[model samples]
Target: MNNAETLDRRALRKAAPVVGITEPGYADHSVEAGILKSIGAEVRLLRWEGKRDKLLDMLPELDVIMIRDLPLLDREAIAALPAGAGIVRYGVGVDNIDLDAARQRGIPVANVPDYGADVEVADHAAALTLALVRRVVSRARQVDNLKWNIAQQEPIYRIAGSTLGLVGFGKIARAYLARMRAFGVDDVLVYDPYVSDDYLAQYHARPASFAEICGKAQIISLHAPATAETRHLVNADTLALMNKRTCLINTSRGGLVDTDALAAALKDDKIFGAALDVLEQEPIGENCPLRGLPNVILTDHTGWYSEASVRSIQEKAALAACEILTTGVPTHWVNRW
Candidate 1:
């Protein structure tokens, strides 16, 4: 090739914008690549294995980053990112990303908050609640072990006359309430300072404090975010307020519940049972206390997963990255400068 041709190719390569996927969990990057290609952007997979040094090394030269729950973009990581590089979280939570740090650095951060996961998340929460209340997992195991017709071994409760308590009144929480309402759970107490009592009344729900919800409801479900104030919202003190017939369900952030405190409560039969989708720690640690508890049902933080939801989040995240590259702004910008 001629020298001029080689120079022109090099210039074109440098001119093309680069978008990095911080953690590659999706099956393929076609959705991102296809969207980014219109703006001459190249999709680069970082495959960050939760390593600080490696992430720092690869931070330079990227115009945008798309991340999903790995190698937390904390203060240091946020500072390491190239100046003005936009960060897009694939899901609703930004707890892994330091929004304040990004704002300080003049880096805009966005999240795929409306990725259509409300239906899936609400459905999962209800399924877990039903499983826990009816001892579905335990009874299935009993039958598997050749112990049939053991209905008297475990007591079951009816959902027809139960009071439902919700920690947050977000989209997912409201969706869950609708499902529970169909099952005759009309009496509801919601604990969201952001939501007004009149608004709660529209849904036939009364606004209550966290303590009131914990103490009064027969079934308490956590739908709040994981923040400084909400961390360990379900601790020993809150669990103590729950009666023996109370059942707990958490499909939101795992950090909302204290793992050790919950295990201790279950061991002591403080509550009837509990079901969890997300945990404070991902891929649950080997020594995690909630591992072998039969009363507790656990899922691999997949409450927001479905083929359609996955596609929706991927498309939305890609569009966010595309906007940041082409327009220097995202539609759902959270941490704005």
Candidate 2:
């Protein structure tokens, strides 16, 4: 065919299949554009918030969706998509994605099961732990308001003397422990039956039972992922076991902690204040009860949002997206290939 005829034929044809993004605020480095040019593929960013009601409507014509929240493709949502489109989770945790639904539909779900992403969360956990113990946010606010009586506004609890209990001995938990050691904390206890003794000894972590970690430690930091067994792990009963002076810190998956029970405990002063970067809900609204409390240092679900870390996640995710779209082989499929 002549040049004009060839152009017309392709123009009448559908644009190549694209890789769509479910999350917003990623550094767009033309990786998608490059891949599309290399092999008749396109990449689009949807940037939609996946609430229960509107998730289905937000998804556009997609060959593949690279998602941060794994559970974005529930049975109802997945049913809304056309066949042959794949599902790819950009990050490690697949708790939010409906694996059974994807498996049933033969839609491959992928996740990069790596420690790199978890390290950012671990570092964030340490930051939140120290911020809570040192009352950094409240102190900053007091100074900003020109009422610089920090000691009166928010008391500084000594972390150096306190014991820090880690719930899970994963990569992030180990990172938090290293940060703690730097701060001169000698009492670091961990409660993960899965973590081997040699690794614990190497990290200078004392292996404690769950009850011991909750009861004896002055600060308890959650480092577990959101699994069926871990949902609301820190419920009313577990919260009751916590030291009255304990400060609960979580940078792990939100479902790991019970928001309702934690809110109640914070209200009643059953425990010291909490420092949380992850909540059961993302894009936590201003009206969220936790937002109204001064005792709780709540972040806007941005624990894993450092420039360096997010860049790495986006790069790998983009590559993974391209790989699936081009090769028909979903890299890092989380639901057992």
Candidate 3:
């Protein structure tokens, strides 16, 4: 190699852009890092540890940013980035990211809406519903404590003839419906304004209002998004409408159900039991009243996870980054400039 050619290569290498990953909780970033490296881009994983100042300090150096649902990227965070830098969300929800701010800055934002997690989420919802309906978790704890024959104390109902209510009839909700049907659930009531009557008929699920589902169904599963209309959809009034034999399951967004109202209902036995995967405040707030309820089941917000799904989301997010770096536009761009 001649000295002139070597100098040209050095200049090109120095011109390569940097991609930063903020507040990453994934086990590894080899896939994303490899993708960025392939494009002659440097990859930096910035574990900010909830320090906004540290994140702000690093943003000016980045050409693209990939983040999960942590250390909120609000207006301040978005403003810290150099103009035209792209942001790629790891998963479907972009509520955590400030899309309007990104749009105002002419920075494109993208999300992986279909990263193959519907099966996992649906399976999780069904698992939580079944566990709550059968009192599995409580009974297991009782057995561990050497308590015997405690099942008779709390009346257990048959699941075969019960009515199942789905709050949203999206892909995940349809998957859940199939699973519930396997258990011989006779009636399926769905409440989704966007879904058509023909679609409900195709699944043999009846279309009903949200209030009707809350009042009439034996098992109500929430699969709605977090929006102004859906926020606190299941509040005190809806909780009151629920039958005493009903078991509520939420594997969707936490904002769909009001935690305070649910806590009150559970305390008074207004509803039979409730299972929740996502909480309004993650890690659960210190004052969360649902913590010690015997009739309530709680799981970390991990319903949309599996070994395969994790890899898929990482690859898709990385691909979005790759697209942005190569063409100044992502394949799944959400915030159009």
Task: Identify the candidate with maximal TM-score.
Answer: 1
Q: Could you tell me how far off, in angstroms, the CA of residue 15 lies in candidate 3 after the best superposition?
A: 3.0
TM-score of each: 0.94, 0.85, 0.93
Which 10-residue span in candidate 2 carries the lowest summed lDDT? 1-10
For residues 107-201, write the lDDT of model 1, one tens digit per residue: 77889999988999999999999899989998998789998887766779899889999999999999999999888887899999999898998
Worst 10 residues of 3 by lDDT: 1-10
Query: What is the Å distance of residue 147 in model 1 from its true position?
Result: 1.3
Q: Which regions of candidate 1 deviate over 4 angstroms?
A: 1-14
For model 1, what is the alpha-carbon lDDT of residue 210? 88
How far does residue 332 in candidate 3 sit from its true spot (Å)?
1.6
Candidates 2 and 3 compared by lDDT, better number? 3
Give candidate 1's total backbone clashes: 0
**What lDDT is reached at residue 249 by model 1?**
97
